[model samples]
Target: MSTEKCVVCKGGGTIELLGAQCPFCNGTGEYTKTGESYLKSHICQCIFLDRKTCPLCGKKCHHDTPNKPKILIGPV
Candidate 1:
């Protein structure tokens, strides 16, 4: 199932999901279409950085990426 896009992060904005090493693609900047959809396109490395703070270090973190990739279904 695809995740419901939030109002702010609906249009390919990785601001809501940013991290150093992206979990989904592991910073490869690529993804697969197997059992995926456009709506769930945001399911990537950024998703792992969803938390506002670092759970391990307990430091304040920011999840904003100016160079966010265009999250679409079929291709990059």
Candidate 2:
């Protein structure tokens, strides 16, 4: 397993919020392997906005009609 500091608050795990502590990391600055890697752990919300397809399988669903749903067939 690999260990690394929190990238959100730059290892301090806390962000100044009008003299209040950051709620994201809770001032710990430490995190462990919970399925997500350290490199890809810190991501902004823009990632979701830029995504138009599945990142894992790189598949895009096409909907023929608004009422009909797109079916995805693949191995999980």
For residues 1-76, write the lDDT of model 1, one tens digit per residue: 2354322223233323342443333333344242134333323344255444433222343323453442333433
Best model number under lDDT: 2
| Candidate 2, poorest ten consecutive residues by summed lDDT | 41-50
Query: How does candidate 1 score on lDDT?
Result: 0.35
Candidate 2: pairs in clash:
none
Any runs in candidate 2 off by more than 4 Å, and if so which? 1-3, 17-19, 32-76
Estimate candidate 1's RMSD in Å.
14.7
**Candidate 2 lDDT over residue span 3-73, tens digit each:** 57554445565643234443444666665343135324332222232334433223453223333234443
Candidate 1 similarity to native, TM-score: 0.22
lDDT of 2 at 42: 32
Instruction: Report how far residue 68 has shifted in candidate 2, in Å.
Output: 39
Tell me the TM-score of model 2.
Answer: 0.30
